[model samples]
Target chain A: MTQRSIQMDEKIISRVDLLNICQDVIEKGNTLLTPGVADYSVVKDVSNLNLDASALPSKISYKSYVFPRTEPVLYYKRSKNDVQLIDVNIDSKKIVILGAKPCDANSLNIMKHLFNWDYSDEFFNMRAKNFIVIGLMCSHFDEYCFCTSVGSSPVSEKGSDIFLIPLDENNYAMKIITDKGKEFITPYSGYLKSGDENRSKRITENVKQPDVAFDSSEVYKWLGENFESPKWEGVGNLCLSCAQCAFVCPVCHCFDITDEDYSYTEGRRMKNWDGCQFGNFTLHASGHNPRDIQSKRYRQRVNHKFRYYVNKFGEILCTGCGRCSRGCPVSVDIKEIVSNCKNDQKELR
Target chain B: MKELIKHARELLENGEVAAVIGYRQVSAKRTKPVIITDPEETSALVFNEYCLNNLAVYLTKARIKLLCKKNDKVLKLAITAKPCDVHSIVALIQENQIDRDTIHIISFNCHGVAKDFGFDFNGDNLASKCITCETHKPLYYDALFGEVKETPQASDTALARIKEIESMPHNERFEFFKSEFDKCIKCYACRAVCPLCYCQRCITDKTIPCWIETSSHQRGNFAWNVIRAFHLSGRCTGCGECDRACPADIPLSLINRKMSMEAKNLFSFVSGRSLETPTLVGSYNEKDNNELFM
Candidate 1:
């Protein structure tokens, strides 16, 4: 495999031209997903797409567009003597995501290493390969946000194919970062004009970032040193074992496979989203569970994100988007827990 | 607030309780649940309109319950709860989930709470459950705190919406709920937050038979939501936690509220109101109406 060089091409397009391009993309039979008030949805009417630079990240990331919550791997049929297997067809339609937050844009890149490590997953690869990420510069953050702590920032263009910075009300400065972005934008060259890089750079520099909450390496070190610390018990007691954090996360990729019977002789094998927070996630057929208690389960969640995944894939699993804390029923903040990981035992007590 | 901290401290310092489950201020307008076993940490305890979580849910968690055992001796676990939250505690006792003697309730005269973390406790922002609340003071408490204060007024739109849904034809009602349940991602945050959903093994998690499909697709989501509502029928205390916790903004409590009304109309029973009365789903009566069955 060869690494592609980052492109330095810059272009500017008015808001209307961007919408026109989006409409064209839709007309070409490609799926166009955009950030809505709540979550990302498919855009049928391009006028409904409002790319507010300061809007908070959508409640759920667009990772599902690549890795669906539930998808069939293969179908099976039974007969009197022999069994037959039916293959599933992966949807190969190109998906163009517009106005994605940088925090969300980097998720699939972090997850790509895992899916390709032990075994190459064609189901994931097919969708991911067909994606064109158009990331937007984020100028907004809240108490729950900590993107800077995890090696991502509001304006960092780590995983975007084409990055956009809003210059004013009607115009955007776009930077084509990859060959795929250039290839996708070439046909729309009639709508794009030469842009002033300095103006966009100033705007990018002005975007406020959430302060670093904790160093990832320090937290990783603390986790490795204190496997049985009482701090786990404290947070474990507070966590309700809901797994909302994992579900809303941009990069928490754990899944389960099950076979569902539609009839007596036919069924499908489904790959669905699963979380480590559930008590039964680690249960065995012998009725023994290694992570039996909520504390141990929670410990796995933290360790996996900061330490274990980093050790295995050389990438931290969390993008620090804060969806978990914002939607937590019991208000268990992952930012707070990881920040406190390096503190002395007395402060936690 | 001072009285609450003082009482919690005294309880912990005197070794009367093993832990105090309460709320701690996280921001100007938000409070998060905090479990403190140390006497000095009780100062962090607070009670205000911003404290939205029903702490009774923590009482049923096995990890939280383990905090009550120290040095081979079992001690009471103390809790700070709102008056509405006490209803959940009462329901848990009625279901025999926890013994009344093993817990200490530190309840307050709540004047309603905000709809969410970053909202003001005003007419427009008042939580739906607080609009029709009749319990300003806890019915059962080991220690009481806070002076009574009047709650802000809000429209009962939730019940009105339920009535509107009921008036719809069966097909339209099904479509409305089908669309709502379609947005479900199957995170089960609703189940985790409900105090009454304290099963060691949930029905969905049982894979040997796989009664409910764990997928988030249309059929799977429908089975899971309907089954969850059926299981929680006549038992939910209307905390509104599930609605708030839902990332997809599903009006989950509306179905539970509608079922609670059914329980009220059919049997003239309200859950968690009286300790002596048995739970409607748990207990059987010979005079029970079998009209639906027939």
Candidate 2:
């Protein structure tokens, strides 16, 4: 890599100057991601520069940007003699996602293993490479948050290019974590000054790990042995088998491919989001479904997150962002469900 | 509340039912659906403004079969029902989805359930169903608990909202629904929570020359939502469970309420009003209004 004239170092940017920086980033032909309003009063992405101060997790995670809900892989046109296949070009533009929580940042780390396991998903791989995540240290937590339980913390800089710690209401102390982060900050040297070393130290001391803790291995062991346990039947009785958990989860990456045709002559093969909790997810062409009951479907969901993923990749799939628990209409708390696994006889009421 | 619990315990203790389906306190503010097979566990059951779930949905053959598998004897269920929930049970019986004899209805005389479990009702906090509900006492019951409350007059707010949507220009209304449905993640929470949407195979799940797209984009979302509302047109009991259960917070009630009004006006039919009356889809008559069909 060629060394740039601007030194890569810690910088201080005031809240007032941050808007200008965001605009500058946009003007330089890079995408600036900030929290805005979505449908149903969800605060997610704003227009250009105005970041929503409400730093609660976005109802839909940023995973959609990398692994979209629906995208066409290829298109085909049939004529009398020939069929022409057309490949869709992927987006290669750089994205700078601002105001990401540590939990949100770490989700990319959990999902990366799947995209690269047996085959490289160029769609996800290219997007993941092109984007730079700027993680903001969390200052608040709600009942649903359990980041500490899943091996992440409020101030974790695991998957971020740049990590921001709030020094006061107006100023932020930015820490460069990767070569991309260093390169991105070089252009903004005018807005930055040498940040205070003690500010970051105080932030590290002040932030507390979330109180939720569990023996994940024990839960995993219980899941392995309790495939046909009667406990699953009772536990999942109230479940709607809805995919709210999967949709809102930061790391859930299951997809289904289908061909949609506008006419007999033209069509596109599309990949869309699919969830294990759905009743038809495991339906077979032989007119049979092995995971026939809601309990079995619900079991597959938790097992995939906490047990199967761990056994396969040596990592748990969830980041404990708490979006699933928060968004579920029935309020099925994963923390409560996983904790109850240790005690087989415990009722789920 | 104590009377309901006492009755539930008595029913469970005597083996009159396999399980008493009711609401149990999950948190200080939330109550979730609980099935108590053990008579001693009846104390966990509670009823108040916080009990918003329509427990009548569990009266399906599939779930009832689960209770029967535990014992060789027939599985008899007893459910705690609010007025609207009782309407759901009547609707289910009308369609032959449930056998009225196998289940016992423990109806409660309720003023209203809150819009959200976390908040207390102050007129505004009552659910949309409660706002228009006149059924303070259950229409049918095997056993009644709590004193009967005076029935409140129906509110015009729901109908007025539908009228407002209808008055919008064609393209604007299209855009309005397009934006609303665009938020759908296709999780099927709406259908899953609905007591009447108990189809064993939902239309969206069929993949052999797929009838409706399962994707969550604008066109797919519109197809799935419109078809679901149409399927529940006259049969829906105005429970507002679908609207409440939607994670996207889509105003699904407006569509259902509009269909309900059209049913009442055009067909002279009111669903779940009585177990004797057949549903709109089930029975046809030569005297029935045929203007819309022509």
Q: Candidate 1 docking category? A: high
True interface contacts reproduced by each model, as a fraction? 0.85, 0.50
**Collision pairs in model 1:** none
Instruction: Give the C-alpha interface root-mean-square deviation per candidate.
Output: 0.9, 1.9
List candidate 1 stretches off by more than 4 Å. Answer: A1-5, A347-349
Give the alpha carbon lDDT tens digit for every residue of A1-349 in model 1: 1115465768899999999999999999999999875579999999888699899888788889999999999999999998899999999999999999999988889989888998999988888888999999999899999999999999988888889999999999999987878888999999999999999999988888899999899999999998988778777778888778888888988999999999999999999999899888889999899998878888898899999999998889999899888888887888988998885754332
Q: Compared with the true structure, what per-residue lDDT tens digits does model 1 show for residues B1-294? A: 899999999999999999999999999999999999899989999999999998899888877778899999999999998988899999999998999999999999888999999887799999999999999999999999989999998899999999999999999999999999988899999999888899988999988799999999999999999999999888988888899888888999899999899999988888888899999998899998777684
Model 2 per-residue lDDT at A191: 82
Question: What's the TM-score of every candidate structure?
Answer: 0.97, 0.92
Candidate 1: how many backbone clashes?
0
With candidate 2 superimposed using the best TM-score fit, by how many Å does residue B22's alpha carbon deviate from the native?
1.3
Q: Which candidate number has the best DockQ?
A: 1
Candidate 1, residue B291: Cα displacement in angstroms equals 3.2
Structural similarity of chain A in candidate 2, as TM-score: 0.91
Error of 1 at B284 (Å): 3.3
